[model samples]
Target: MNKLLLFIIVFTLFSCDSKNIEQNREYNYPASKVWKHGVYSKYEARDLEGVFDGLEVDVIYSPEKNDIYVRRVVADTSKNLPLDEWLAMLKVPSKMSYWVDFKNLSKANAKQAMSIMINLLTID
Candidate 1:
């Protein structure tokens, strides 16, 4: 009975301490990080360089062409910019991080696409 009472007391004390910590903790809304979407062109990326913390660009792999193109739709082949060309136009590539929204990545082109991406990243 004594042991049971002592265990309960210790548990209660620890629980209360944790609750106090949680209650005293402060939170701030709307973090500092910002990300922008639909930045598929070099013009857009150049324009939004300092405006956003991160930029998301859509890319589709063309297995027949053996290259990656920046475009929202895979079917709309016109005005499609090659990934390398688009990346080459960035004024400050290191200023903001990029999030590639791969539109049609599959097992058939994953390896090639990764290779192209690696090459793109390595280009100085």
Candidate 2:
């Protein structure tokens, strides 16, 4: 009958629409505007809490204390920023991506570094 044919056509159209929606459901993240910027570093005089799309830093781990330090070189203790304080200084912690360049990260300090990053950066 005409009613049966109409019902089948409507169901087919809805099924195709649903399939199209599913195919376009992929998430699109925002692209970075700035290539690179400094968040906190001794070399730059900018504020430590400045807003940036990404952070490029050199990290060094202290074996004795099991703590992480941010510095260009491991020997330069004076310019080092502790992991906790550094995270606290970020203007937008959640929105920023960190490019951590671990300096002299030995196998002994690898676990400690991972733990420090997880504890500080993990959003509850």
Candidate 3:
């Protein structure tokens, strides 16, 4: 009778431990993971292929042309693409987000900036 009781106790303890371990294993890792990645100045249109979850572009208002342009320097004038044209070059994914850093815009240009951004973002 004592041997049978001991066997039952051991079996109960082992079963309880197994259940605890199984519960802990379920919480060992997260259900989902997120990654943040992007590019800097002078990034090519083709550079945004399957690698990034975001894009950061520097936008400066061109008072001369009455438009917004993307570049680190307004005076460099080498290979900078206007904001609309640059955005047109890439087919942005629905999941990807954009960080538009507006540079050197006056209060009057703010409305234009907002309008341009709204129009750009609402495009299909």
Report clashes for each candidate as comma-separated counts.
0, 0, 0
**lDDT of each structure?**
0.81, 0.66, 0.64
- TM-scores for all candidates: the values are 0.69, 0.61, 0.58
lDDT of 3 by residue, 1-124 (tens): 9999999999987777543454434432322243332243334543663455556777787777777787666775775567777666566644455677876777978877788777777644
Off by over 4 Å in 1: 1-32
Displacement of residue 69 (Cα, Å) in model 3 is 0.8
Candidate 2 residue lDDT tens string, 4-76: 9999999887777543454556643436655354434633312432444556777788887778877767678
Top-scoring candidate (TM-score): 1
Off by over 4 Å in 3: 1-43
Error of 2 at 73 (Å): 1.5
Query: Scored by Cα lDDT, where does model 3 land?
Result: 0.64
What are the runs in model 2 whose C-alpha is more than 4 Å off?
A: 1-30, 37-51
Instruction: Quickly count the clashes in candidate 3.
Output: 0
